[model samples]
Each structure stands twice: as structure tokens, then as C-alpha cells.
Target: MNPYLIVPLLALFLNLSLFTYVLALKGKHRVVHLYLLYAGDLSLWIISIVLYWSFLPIHWMPWIFKISSISWLLAGTLFLEFVFAFLSKNPNILLYLLRGLALAIFPITLTTDWIIGGVERKYWGDMLLPGPLYVYGVNVLIVTPAVYAIFLLLYESRKEEIGFRKQCYLLAFGTFLTSILGFLTTILPRILSQGDLHYPPLSGSASVIQSLCVFIAIAKYGFLEIRLEKIALQLYSKLREGVILLSTADELLYWNESAKEILGFSKSSSAPEKLDLGNFLDGFTRKPFTRMDFKKKSESPAKEIRIDDETIYSTGPVYLEVSKSEIPISGRDLGKVYVLRDITEKKEASEKINMLYSRVVRDLDIAREVQNTITTRTFPDSEKFKIFSYFRPYDHVGGDVLNCAESVDGKIEILFADVSGHGISSAMVAAMASISFNVVSRKGSKPKEGLLFTNDLLSSVVTQHFISAMYLRFDPKTLILEYSYAGHHAGLLLRKGETLDLPGKGGVLLAVGTPILEDYQIQLQAGDRILLYSDGLFEVRGSKGIPMGNTTLVEAVKKLSYQDSDGLIRSLVSYSESFGDGIMTDDLTLFCLEISESA
Candidate 1:
């Protein structure tokens, strides 16, 4: 083998390698395909040069020279196509026309002597003799298009982003170098010397420099889809979540800064290149990182682990949410990506919130117990009259209070009050109202007088809330009933299947204003029932979003007039609950008084 033949042979090998590598890439895009076309042409040009120098036979020289001519002629058009594809630009008409010209001139070189002309045996090797149109062909077909492609790349690089622009500049510089070296070593010698060149053409060997430059651009600055991979890696490195990539053999391929920080790896030290998954996770945990059992499972849920190493976490124990997912390619398991999220703050905050919530719940339970003791759970019943009361608070504590007591004169005093709202504050107001009622009831005040006294006390003490109340007094022997209201809903009097509203004379809410109440008297016949209730029952909304107003409640009470006092209150509560889908928007209170038939 001649020493000079080694250069073209090596160049041929490099071109073939570049072509094969690009073709073998998975999911090859348009730019890659165009590059493959360019590379294939370049390889052909080098192959023809190698064959021409081999001196195969006297007759084969013309054919090899013709092949070399065709390849070199098409090189510029193919490279321009690749440039356009790389820049993501649509080719102009000029590109199409130049491609057509190259194709049209290719057959001319192969079938006729217009372009290749003839071959001459030189001291170094066989060289192609230039035809009459060879100069025009070389300039028009090869030099012009290659120069234009490099110019376009340089012009477009300025508008690109910093990273991509670097790639474009590198590519342009490589192509320029290839063009300059190829022209000087091959075309210049051939045209200047005609057919009697003393030295062998080194254009094929010179192409290796361009291929090396392209490879450098691909490896360092990232060209084509490799640039996308570089971008992904940069983003992955910046993630707050720790990410670790492992090969199928459990070798550590990649890990981000966050992964190092999470695993408590020394920040100053570099990662070991040959570390396995087990060694990577060794010092991070004591239990073999959940025994690496998650890798065995096809679908694994995120696992929370507590790191109690005081040396790593100075504040306290660190909580991490670790998850693993298999990275598969083309139905084959490539590796696994382990993600670690620092959930220490979230975990601690959640625990603190739960503690506060538990304390509130316990306090509310105690408040409900105290309110239950203060509010009346049972009402006094007698042969002459039967009393029934029901109360349901919207929350753990209620604003509604119902109480019944016998005065010094033996008159049964009943008071039912609803504060402005439900919950702890309102329940406290209800308790105050209960105490006020008890104090006035012991003094044996009249129905109107009792409300006035209760209002006076509440108005002076409570500022944020008010109370609506009804006070009633009954004489068992006389069968007479006296009632007064303070900004409360009208009580219903059920008599002989007729419902009548027992409206108050001066209805003013307590605690907000002075009470000016008037007591009303009604003669109660045997079996007559009076119903007193808070606004919560009628204020509820049904499924159609319509409120169960006072009119609907009065009609419902009239329908259930035949039932006894307890049964009537129970049925009414059930009706309201059913209408509102068992959702209580406010505190509910019901007090029913019935005169027995025997009375």
C-alpha cells in the first residue's frame, strides 16, 4: 500500500462512520436525514478518490473519475439542503433550481465527456482531465452552493439564541474550512495543471477535518437533537426535586445537585463515576432505602422516609418523598429515574395544623358539654298541659335556648330564645339569656315584663350579637295563655284544624335595642296546641334552592295538628330535615305546648 493512499482511505473511513452514526440514531429528524444525504454524497466522493488512486485498470479509470465528478458536483447541493434543514428554514427557489442543475449535470458527467473528459496516468496516481465546461461546472455546481450555504449559516447565527448560535457558527466554520481545503488541494491543482498533476489529490483526506469539526460541535455545543438533550440536562440540573438516573445494571448514570444535597453527599466532593445504585444510597439511609423493594414492583407508589441524622439536618429530622419510575425505550427497560422531594416543611406544617385542630375540637367538646348543662333538655309536663322541646345546633355548640320553670304563683313560665348566630359565641349568648329568664321567672314577672328585663340585661352585656325570644305564661286551672315576643317569629296556635299566627304587639330584637313588648292573652280550649320556634327551621333551603318560609312552616304545622305535642315537634323536625337534605344551615329550636283533652 502506497503511503499517500492511506490519507484518502482514512477519510473514506471517517465519512462512512459519520454517515453510519447519523443513520443509526433513533428517532432521526429531518435535519438528521438531510445530514445523512450530505454524508452519503461525501462518502461516495471519497470512495471514488480511493478507487481512482488504486489504479484498478486502464479502462476503469474513466468510470471512477466520472463517479468522483458526479459526487463532488452534488456535494454542494446536498450540503445546502442539510443547512436549510438544520436552520429549520424552507428552501428558496434558488436551492431547488441548483439541485435540479446538479441532477441534470450528473448524467452528463457519467455518459459523456463534457464534464470529466478523460483520465491521465500521473506519477502519484490517475487524475481526471478537465473538460471544456469543467471550470464552469466546478464553480457553478460545487463552489457557489457551498459558499452560499456557509453564508446563510453565518447570517442566521446572529438571530439564534446564545447556545444554538454557537452551534451554527461552528458548523459554518467547519463547512468553510472543508470548502477551502478541498478547493486548494483538489480543484485548484486539477484546473491549473489540467490532466498532468504531479501530486495525488488530498481533497478526500481534507474532508476529515470538516467531519471532526461537526463531531466537536455535536459533542460540546450540541448540534441537531443533541442540543435538545443538552437543554433537558440543564433543566434537570436546576430542579428543586432530586433526580437520579440509573442504568439497567444499577450503575449510576446521572444525578443532579439536588440529589446530592438530599442524600447528604459532601457538596465539595465530586460524584464517583463508577458508583452503583446500592453504594449511592448506602450512607443515605439505614434500611437499604426501603430494601430496594420498589425496583421489583412494576408500579410503585411514592414512599415517605424520615432521616434522623442530626449531622446532615441540623434543625431536625428531614422528611423526603421518594419515588421511582422505569425509563423504557422501544419496549426495553433502559433504566430508572429516582426522584426525591424535600417534604420536611410540608410535613411539619401539616403536623402543627393537626395539633391546633385537635385542641380546638377538644375545647368545643367541653363547651358543648357546658352548654348542654345550662340549656333545658327536659320540659315540665302535667295533667293539664304537656310540653315538648327540640334543639339542634348547626355546629358543636348552639345559639338556641329553651327553658321552662314554675313561678312563685304556680304559673308555668316558658322561654325560647335564638341568638344572632350559631357556634361558641352565640352559645354563650344563649346561656346568658337562659340565666336572665331564670332570674325573672323567680320574681314572677308578667310575660311582657320578663322579656323587657331579659332584653335590658342582654343589651348592656352583649354588643356583637342579639337575641330573638318568646316568653309564655300559662294558668292550668283557668285555661288561659299569655305570650310575648321580642323580634321573634310569630308563634302558631293550632285550634280545630285552623292555624293562626300569634303576632306580637312590639317585636324588637334583644341586645341591640330597648325592648317594648306587649303580652297577648288567648283562651285555650282542651286539646289546643301552641308552637314556638326559631327562624332556623324556616330559613333552610330545599333541594330547589327555595327557602322554607314562615308561610310554608305554618301550613306544615296545621297539617300535623292532630298529633300530640311531642309527636308534632318530632314530625316537624323530620319534615324540615327532609326538605333541606338533612343539612342544617342554622341552629333549630322547637317548643310545643298542648292542653290535654281532660283539662
Candidate 2:
């Protein structure tokens, strides 16, 4: 055995392994298939050389030499096809001409000796002797296409990104090196020495360098689509989200481990290689997904899928937020990339929050109903006075409360209170205040004593909150009004078309402090009216941030004093709403009373 035969043997082994590996890949692109054709040609060339050097019969040398020449002749054409595919470029007229020439000369080389005349016996092995058309064949069929492919690769390298450019440069360098070594060791020597070269052809051995270079490019820089697909598969398998790749024809190109798990494929089950996307989805759900279903899903605005088949998924339920995007190469639609993220936990949590919110809203509605029942009362229909009340809460439930009771001694007791805050907590306090007011009124306590008792009850039970209230008592026989304030605004007394403030001093907020409630007495005349309200009326601020102060309310009351009790209260509320631009920041309550002339 010649020791020099080891080189071509090694080249043969490497190229055959690369070609087999590429062929065995599941989903291969055009560039990878082209590379497989190129590598198979090189492996054939190496195998011919390896057989030529072996101890074969002497008569077979010519046949082996012709096969080797034919392999070399096809090498350049296959490599150019691979280069054009890799660069995503269409074949030009030059490529078509080269292909035509290679195909035309294929039969001639097999039948005649125009390209490979004969084989010469050398010390190492048999060398191919150049024929009459050998130089033209080598230059036009082999060297021309290889050089052109390398030039195109170099030109494309300049326009590519750094990673792809490195891959291009490596492939170009490998092709250039293979061409140079083959030309020097085989073609150049054969042409120069006129078939008297001492050494056998080593172009088969030189192909090993190109193979190794392409391997390096694939391993490190992802030169071929095969490497990128492998890398994408690895990354997708490790992701928590499921990923599925499909060709434009709905062929299942690739699916990661996560996708298999999400689609309910057991570990022991073997997935079919030729399974279409529609069939895969059909197995995943109860209803089969048709081709049109997949197309609509890819184009639809709503891109979510809910899978609740207990038989498919051992778990309770699966909610997937699915998105699809088209994979395009050089403006050509290659495939679709489908990503599915499990949102079961997120959906469950949102449902829990909504449930709690609904429960709270229902409770608030019931509380509002109860509060309206307690606060809305029929004031004593007395001949001496006509009483009217209005209440509006900022929310479903509020802090402001109003209550009126007629004592056995013909004393009409009225209480208007505003708790510190809004919502459920304040509404609770208002309820407590209403009960306390009724209890104190039954005891026939004076206006000042009633407030003192109510403040003491609230201060002991409530924390971080206080109440502001105005308590009024009117004796119909004496025509005298008595009022006391607990950190509350003064009441308005309307007499002879003029507004007067029924002011009281030394009042403090209830529940938080001891109130120094002073009793204020007003000599009520026939046809005179009085109005008491919570601070929400005048504290309202408009768009300009100006509060509608008590002075404004007094002026407005004087202008509207001619209306009856119901009309007066409604008109006042409407005026305040207009002043605040229909935005309420706090609860509002108004109580109005008119003294009849017949009294």
C-alpha cells in the first residue's frame, strides 16, 4: 500500500461523513442540499484517486482515471451552485452556460478520450495524462467556475454582517486554497511537463482542507442553514415557551421539546417525520384544525388558544397565548414561526381578582340600600314648620347622614353629620351616629347635650376618624330655634329676604376631641326659613381651583329664598353641582325648614 494514499483516503472519509450527516438532517434548505451535492462530488473524486493508488488490475486504470476526471469536472459546477444557494442569489447566464457545458461533456468523457486521454504509471500511483482538450476542459469546466464562485463569495462577504461575512470569507478561502493546490500539484504540472510529472495527482488530498474549512465555518459561524436550524432547535428546546416551525405548505419542519410537551405528546411516543401542522394541531385539540383554520389563525387579530381537554393534558387546564410570524428569506416566504406561552396561572389570578371585586361591589350595594333606608325618613308633618332633606354620597356608600325626629314635647330634633372619610368605614360611622341620634332624641336631650352624648359615644368606639355635626331643636309653641355645632358649619337663617349666619363658637370635631358646644338661640319670625348643611356644599372646587365658599352659598340662598322647602333644597344642590362642574369630591347633605305664617 502506498503511504501517500492515506491523504486521499482521509479526504474521502471526511467528505463522505459530511455528506451523510447533511443528508440525514430532517429539514434541509436548498443551500444544504447544494452543499451535499458538492461534497458528494468531492468524495467521488477522492474515492477514484484512492482506488487508482490501490493494487488493482492494470486494465482498470484508464477507467478509474476517466471517472476521476469527470468528478473534477463536476466539482466546480456543483460548488458554484452551492455558492449561489448559500448567498441567496439566482443563477446568472454564466452559471447556466457552465452547467450546459458540464452536462454536454459528461457523455463525451465517458465514451471518448477528448478530456482525459490516458493514465500514466508513476512511482506513487497512476497519474491522469492530459488529452488534446484537457487544458480547455480544466480551465473552462473546473477552474473558471471555482474562481467565479470564490469571487462572488468575496464580494458578498463585504455586504454581509460580521458573523455571516466571516463565514463567507472562510468558504471563499477554502475554495481558493483548493483551486490553487489542485492547479499546482495536478493541472499546472500536467500542462507544463507534458505528461512527465513524477508525482501522482494530490488534488483529492487537497480537498480535505476545503472540507475542514467548511466544517469550521458550520461549527463556529453557522455558515449553512443546517447549523442555524440545529442551534434554533437547541434554544427552543430549552425555552419554557413552546415553539413550532412550519413550511409554507403546512409541513411540520421542526418542533422543540417544549412544543411536544405542550401538545401533550408523551415521552415514549414517537413523532412522525412527515406530519403536517394541521394533523399535529388536530391531535392537540378535540376538534381538528383544518388548513384554513391555520391560515386564519396566522392572519387573525386574536392569537390565543385555550386547551381544556383533560384527556390530552393531565393538568387542570391550559391557556396559551399564541403568536405567529412569517419567516422570509430575500423577500421569499419560507415558513411560519409559531410561539405559544402558557398563561394559565395568569388567567386564574385575573379571575380571582375579578371575583373579589364583584363580591365587594355587591356588599357595597347592600350597604347603600341599608344606609338609604336609615337616613331617608319622613320628618314630622307639623303645622308650625315644613322640613325637607337631601343627601348624595360620592361613592356607593358615603359618610354624610341626616335624621329628623319629633319628640313627645312637640320639639322637632334634627341632626346632620359628616364623617371624616368616605366609603365603607365612614358609612359605618354614619350609621352609628344615626342610631345614637335617635336614642338621644328619645331621651329629650337639649341640642348641646345631645351633641355631647353623641360625641362621647363615637370617640370611644372609633379611631383615626372624627365627625362634624349640627344639632337643632325647635319648639313649635314658643317659635324659638336652638342649635349647637360640633366642628360644623353655621346654619343659615333667612328673614325678610336677607340671609343671616346662625353662628356658634367653641366647637371641636367629634370622636377625636371634646366638643365645647355652645347653645345658640334664634327668635324665629313667621314665614322665616333656616338651612343647615354639610361642608361638602361650599368646599367644592371648580376647574379654576376656586372653592365655592360659604359667602357664595349665603348670597345664593338669599336670591332663592322665595321657593318652597323642596324646591329650595333642589335648587341649592343644582347650583352647587354647577359651581363644581358636576364633580363631587365629598358627600353632600342639605336640610331646609320653613316657618309657616299660621304658626
Candidate 3:
């Protein structure tokens, strides 16, 4: 068995296998199928070359070379036809007729030494060259068709798919180089070496290498149908959101991986019959579809489907959309391909984003806790100083700090400070100031001394944005009430049927870097009473659009002096609320202390 004969037979088998694989591949284009068929012709030529060079006998050599050469010519002609079919609207008949003519010339050359002339036998092998009309005719037939094939390939590659064109060009260039090298290295060298020359045979490996490289290029780049179609199919299957494809027969043709996960379907195939699709999606409360008969040519392709009462935990119904399109078949309508995309997550996210402020409802609950800690919690013993306090914060939280405590001298110290700003941040500062007030009062300082201490601490600790307050201390035994102001509104003192705005010029507010110099003293008699309040209680604007100034506050206190401390705070709140037209913008806090020997 000759090695060359066996190699050609094997190469022919491999080539046929590749061509068959191309036909088996599923794709949309007929031109692609034609190109693969042409490539098969080239494979046949390569195999024929192997068989011809196997050196049977002298009598068979010329006939074998003639047939193999004719096969090569047909392969090159097919290559051009493939390109013309791919690039142009139709095949060029003139080129086809010329290719037929070239084939006809092969038989004529065989009979007479007209085309290939005669084969001359040498020691190594036999060589075929042109003679007479066939001498230039062979060159014309081969080179003319080859040049045309090259040009057609160039033009087709430009018009075809980007990746496909690249692969085709790669295959064409590699084939050209290999064919040139095969002829030069084997045939030309053997002829030029004259009779005694023996050149190493150019192995069938050149065509094999070229074929494999082109096959790889085709598999990786040219034949994209399998890869792209697989991706499309997989995406339709695996999407977690519901997906449904409705075909021409009003039938469900496809579903995706996630369609089942979200839409509550089992592993039963994604495609449901049209009736089944309706049944599966029946529970949804959505706008009526125009008809259950899936329209192949619908004016609109997308619509939202709403599902109500889906689950107990859901905030509301879930919404989904079906995107539909007509799947175009060459002569047949494949109905509408519909995709069901569950947009439940997107809807939920959008709703959550819209009501972002709802989180503040939770914060309001926290604000209530802060109010409890800052207000009544500061002084637990209401029994000690006959202390009566009313604190009402306007918003969820406001800037108000109130204090009541017994000093070392048996005097009751009380004050209300208003910090600037609002919301949680201001409320926080107010809480801190409340704690500071209690701490300083327990330090056993006079009303003024405590005020100075608090002011100093607040000045260091708080921001300049806050306002300081008034502190009042009443000594029951001494009948002396002392007060200190830190940039606070005046404290009202009512005596002898006249309104007295006790003069209070104070140091800068606490937490503000201002000098601590202002303190005032007052004589407390048996019938005199004092009002300690946040500015919110007095400076509040009335319906008449006037702040309830010191004069009006003094008058209100005069009438309320006879009431107990609790009654006094209530009366003041009522009065302030009425004056402000029932609008409380700031936190209102008040503590009233009346001097009575009977208590």
C-alpha cells in the first residue's frame, strides 16, 4: 500500500466530513450553505492532487494529472460562484457559462496534446506542461478564473457580515498561499531540477494546514448562527423574570429559565399551548387582551399585565409586561412571539423610592422617646418645689429644654432654654442642655451662680446657633427671688397692680463664646409670683399678627397669679395657643412658681 494513496483517501474523508458539518449547522442564510458547498469542492481537489501524485503507472499518470487539474479548476470556479451568490442579488450566468467552457476544454486537451500537451516521464515522476493552443489556454483558464475568484471574494467579504467576511478573507488568503507554495515547492522545483533532480515532496500537509486554519476561522467567526441562536434561546429560558413567547397559532412557543422561578411554573417545558397560557396567567387582574387569538401582526407589541391578590405579604399587585413581535418565516406567518417580563421588583423599587420620607415615621417614634427623656424625666419629683411644667413640642421634636430642681439653700431653681433650629439635631442639643441644667443645679449654686455655670458649660459645648435662657431661684425663708438672664427674653414680675418686666441683661448664651456678666436680683414678697418660660410661650405671634409681648404676658400672669402652679402653666398654655391662632411652631414650655406661705 502506497503511503501517498492512503493519505489522499484520508484527506478526502476528512474534507467530506467538514462539508457535511457545515450543511448540518442551522442558520438563516442560503448563501452560507452555498459557500460551504464550494469549500467542499476545494476539498475534493486537494484529495485528487494526493491520488494523482501517488504514481500508479506510466500509462495512468497523464490521465490522472489531467483529471486532478480539471478538479482544481472546478474548485476555483465554485469559489467564485459562492462569492457572487453571497454578494449580488443573483448569480452571474456569464461566469457560470465560462466555467462550463473551461471544463469542456479539459476533455479536448486529454484527447489531443492541445491543452495540457503531453506528460513527460522522468526518473522521479511525470510532468505535464502546456502545448499549442492549450499552452496559453491552460494559463488563461486557470489564472483568469483565479483572478476573478479573488476579486469576487474581496467584494463579497465587504458586503457580508463583519465577522463572516473576516473569516472568509482569512480562508481565501491561506488557500492562495498554500496552493502557490504547493505548486512551487513540489512541481516547479521538480521540473527545474531537470531529469536527475529529486526534491522532497511537499506533503499533503500544506492543504491540511490551510484547511484546518480555515475550518477554525469558520467555526469561531463565520458560522455564528449556532452561537447567537443558542444565546437567544438561553436568555429566554434562564431569566428570573417571567418570559413567554407566543407563536402564530396563538400558542406559547418559548419560556425562559427564570420564567418558572417567578411565574410559579414547574419544569414542564416553557412553551404552553395558547389555552394553557391563558389559564396559567388567568389569576392576574389586568386589562383585557384584545383577543386570546395571538395576533401575528399586532399594531402594538408591548402591554402591562397586573396581578392582584398574588400573595399575602405583597404590598400590592405585581405588574408585568409582554413584548410581542411577529416571527417572520419566509412564506409562513409564525404568529406573534411574546415575552413576559416580570417588572415586580422594578415597581417595588420605584414605589419605595417615591416614599423615601416614610422612614421619618419611625424617627418620630424615636423623637417621642427623646421628648420623654428631655422634658418630664429631668425632674422626677413634682412634689418638691410645687413644680408644674407643660411641654408641647410642635413637630416630632423641637428645641426646648426645661428644668426644675431644689438647690442646696432650699430654693427652687427653674428655667426653660430654647435652642435654635429644629428636627433631630436640635432636639439632641436640647436634651444635652437639659442634662446640663440638672447637673449644674445640683452643684449647689445660687440661681445666678447656676446660670453662670450652665452658660459657661453650654458656651463651651454647644454651637453658636443656640440661644441661652433665664434662670430663677426663690428662697421661701428669705422672701428673696434671684434671677439671671443669658440672652433670654425678660421674665415677667407682677406686683402692686402694675406690670413689671424684671430687667434682665445677661451674658452671652451657653455654648456661645460670649462674656458671662449678666445677673439680676429681685425681692420676692408673699403675694408676688414669677413666670419661667421658653420664648415660644410669649413671643409667639397672635392672630392679630403681633407677638404676645412682655406687657400682654404680664397682664395674663396677673390674672393667673391666684392659680396653683399647675393651673398657672395650663392657663398660660391656653392663652399662648389662643393668641398664636392655634398654631404652635416651636416647643412651648412653662413653669410657674407662686410665693404662698400656706404651701
Candidate 4:
């Protein structure tokens, strides 16, 4: 309400509002809040001056005087923090130690009168005589940091651009201006005039110089190009993902820390607005990164670069994935944000995985060759019988066996087996079963005897494993087809185009126990064909997701009556696969034999 209080009250309101506004901008620019905190404290010191220079309640003068010194202490402490950060110095021990000392001094000054001695009223206003240790403590904790800050600015300004250098000079000038004014108005007038004439209001005038720093600090984010909001800038700076603000007019508006380090280069020091897009890519690629294809006006999909070689300006030497999105303001391309992520560990690990995968594939190829040699046998070289064999493993190698051989006595012996499970172990069982079959068949044994020999051969060696096999002995002269099986699929006899099942009327699985082989005999007519297959061929799921049994296989064989032995086997596998929805349940094998009229 007083005339002198008007300007001070207005200054107080303006500073408080500024503090709140800058606090809002903290998410955009963290240091902005520190600047406002310092400025707010300075304003509080001014309010104390306004109170003293007016007709205040006399009792409030001492408390107001004490608080003024408190504001001075806070202003100096907060300003030190702001200055260190503005210089791009990260949080270090030295900074925290200095801050610790300031905090330590804070509790002492609040309780004791080491900072504010006593207040006396003059004709026009009140004067607070300096405390005993106030001058030294205030000068040491507050003014000294500010003086050192000016020297630091000048020293570091050497490598900076013209604009940065100008900002530094302006900031240094403001510091000196405040210090000179404080000495002149707070101390000199009282000492020189040798009277009780003391006016601290003149000390508050130093605030004009401090405003210069705030103005200069605003210019630091490149000439007020806050087109990228403070939130965006803060987010961009903190993120490992970078943000690059390139104005629609080809001007560089912003480049975050990650953008500079990851992209290799930054905006021109001589001309910040004029950025070479080519230079921008140096951070991501070892070679010249010329893939400038995403020039779409709207937001673009992310693009990845897997540089197997060296990289520049990056955190690691291995790999990087970079993406750019055009910043659209009001549906117009205002700039671009570049997000960079370091995929070095993932890239190296993937390369190792691929190398391991290649080795696995190579090993599987060798296993496949060995399994092929063991599972498949030479077909009988005969004129009366046409034997066709089919084998397919679920993956790399299979556990299904198909073999046929003609004995010296003109009797053809055939063996087909499917091991219990799939993969390398089962394929090994199939391989061993084929060897046993070949050895017994060459010995001129009957189908049942050959089955018994194979059962004994696998019983001791195969643990947690068994074989379901069918052995066949066909006499070309007699046209007598004698087939025996052990826990295997029944033979399909297609006699004059009518499907007939031999049934699984056999013994226990081979390797589980001795097998009492039951032979099923069928006389070959003018045109008779028999289908022998492993359980893997007939034990897959049907169209309704039901397990396909031999009956369904025989039905499929019936449907393919028009097909020859080879065509029918091919269609059998195709139909079985269709029911599985393109997935394989087990290793598949189908062995077929047709009798020609020459027999």
C-alpha cells in the first residue's frame, strides 16, 4: 500500500510467477528450474528492502532483516549449482562437496546471528549492520563462487562458437556488475558518510544485472528455437535414443547428446543452423552412410543398419540401429527426431548364434549321410518284382528304414522299420535295424527267422527304445508272398484294385523281448501289389485332428486305386501331410512291391 512498496511488491509477484513457470519447464530443461530458484531467492531479498523502506509494523522489521540475509545465502548457493550445470559439467564429488558446505552453513545461520547482527531505523529507512562473521561467510560462500564462475566462463570460451563466447562475456559482465553494485549501496554509503544514513534499496538495484544472465541462458538452446518443447529436449537429452531437430527449411534446430555422439558429427560450429546431413550419418556407419531414402514429409518407419565392421562416433565399435521420425507441427514437417540404439552386444551374440547354427547344420548333414547308408539298402535286381521305396525324416535325419535285397536262391527279402521316437537317436536305431536286416537276409533266412534275428540283435543295445518292423520274403517262381511283422503297421494288399489289410497280428516290439513272428501269406495274382510302411507313415493325425490309423491309410490307398505303386506311395505321404496341417508327427517310410506277369 505504501509508495515504496509498490515497485518491490510488483517485482516480488513477477519473480514468483517466473519461478512457477520455470518450474513447469523443468521437464523440458532441468536447469531452467535452478535458474528460477536463484532468481526467486534474489526477489525475496528485494522484498525485505521494500519492507524496510516503508512504514512497516515496527515489530516485523527484525524478522524481515534476518530473512533477507537468509535469501542472500540461498540465492548464492542455488546459483552455484545452476552455473556448473550450464557449463555442461556433470554431477561430480567436488560439486556435491561444495553444496554440502553450503548446506552445513545454512543450519548455523538460521539459528544464530552470525549472518544478521541487528537492525536500526534511520530517518527514511532501516539499516541492518553487518554481523561479525557475516561479511566473510557471505563473501566466501556466495561472492567467491560467482567470481570464480566468471573466470571459468572466460577460460572455457576459447573452443566455443561466437554465440557461446558472446553469452559467456555477457554472463561475466552481469556478475561483475552485481558485485560492484552490492559494495557501493550496502557498505560504502554507511562507511564513507560517517552517519546513520543507510539505504539497502540501492543494493537491490544489482538485480538488473542478474537478469542479463537469465536472458543469455535462454539464448543457449540456439537462439530461442524451442520448437522442440522443453519436455522433448529433456527427453531427447536423457535418452540413449537421440533426437535430431532439423527444421523443414533445412536448418538444424537441435541435436541431443546421443545424436552428436552416436551420429558422429553435430551442427556446424560456425553456423549451427547449417548442418550437413552427410556429416550427420558419420556417427552411425563406418563407411559413408548414404541411405538418405526416408525423405517423406510425414513420420517414417524406422530403418536399421547392421554394420558388421567398424563404426564412428558411437559408444561401441560393433553395431547400431538408427531410426528417424519427421516432427510434424500443424500437419507440416517442422523437423526430425533421430533415435539411436546400440545393438553391439545383440549383434555380436547373433553372429555367434548364426555361426553355431551353421556348425549344427554341417554336423546334421554328416549324420544324414551316415543314417542314409544304414537305413537304405540296394533294391533286388529282378524281372518279376518292381520294388519302390520312399523315406522322409521329420528333420535332418529320420528313424524310418526301407530295404530290399534278392538272395542267391531267387527269393527277395524286404525290411521296413520305424523306431519309437524321432531325431538322431531314433535314426540310429533305424540304421542299426537295417544292418541287422541286411545281414540276416543275405544268410538266406525266411521272413520269421529274419525277424527273430533282428529282435535278438537290438534287445541288448537299445535302452528306452524299440523298433516296429515288417519283414517280407517273396518267391518269384511260386508267387508266394510270406510277410511277418513285429509291432508294425499291417501290409496293404491291393489285389486287382481292391484294398486288403494284413492286420497287425504280430508280436511284441523288437528290442523289448524275443519276437514270436506270425507270418501272413498272400498269393500274387496277375496284378497284385503290397504296401509295407512304418508307423510314422500311418500314425499321423487326420483332417479332424484324429490319429490316422492303418484303416485310414488303407482307405487313402483305396482312393488312389488308379495310381501305380509309385504314385500311390507319393499320394499316401501327401495325404498324411495334409492331415497334419504341414507338421510332421514322425519319420515316414513307405515300401511298395508290384508283381509283373513275367513271374
> Which candidate number would show the highest TM-score if scored against the true structure?
1
TM-score of 2: 0.41
Please, what is the whole-model Cα lDDT of each candidate in the order they appear?
A: 0.73, 0.74, 0.59, 0.65
Worst 10 residues of 3 by lDDT: 291-300
Q: Which residues of candidate 2, in runs, are more than 4 Å off?
A: 24-27, 226-599
Name the lDDT of candidate 4. 0.65
For model 3, the superposed segments whose C-alpha errors exceed 4 Å read 1-367, 377-385, 496-498, 510-512, 542-546, 559-565
Tens-digit lDDT string for candidate 1 (1-599): 75668888888888787767556653357777778778888888887877777767879888778766778888888888888877767899989998899989988888888887888877566888888888788888778888998889889766444446667888888878887987887678766776446677666567788888777665544466544344465688899888876655554556778887777676766665444444433234323242232121122244343222212112245556667777642123355677877655444434432333343345776567647855677767689888878888888888898888887777898888888888987876776677667667887778888888767656655678887788888988898888888888788888888888886666665644676778889899998888888888888899999998988988888888777777888998998989889887899888888888889
Q: How much is the lDDT of residue 349 in candidate 4?
A: 35
Off by over 4 Å in 4: 1-10, 26-36, 57-60, 84-115, 120-124, 148-176, 187-201, 219-243, 247-273, 276-335, 338-599
- Which portions of model 1 show Cα errors greater than 4 Å? 23-27, 159-163, 189-196, 222-225, 228-393, 396-599
Clashes of each: 0, 0, 15, 4
Candidate 4, position 405, lDDT: 77
Better of 1 and 3 by lDDT: 1
Clashing residue pairs found in predicted model 2 = none
Residue 234 in model 2: lDDT: 68
Query: TM-score of every model?
Result: 0.45, 0.41, 0.36, 0.42
Each model's Cα RMSD: 23.0, 26.3, 26.6, 23.0
- Which pairs clash in model 1? none
State the lDDT of candidate 3 residue by residue for 472-533, as single tens digits.
76676676777777777777665555546778677556544554655567777765656667
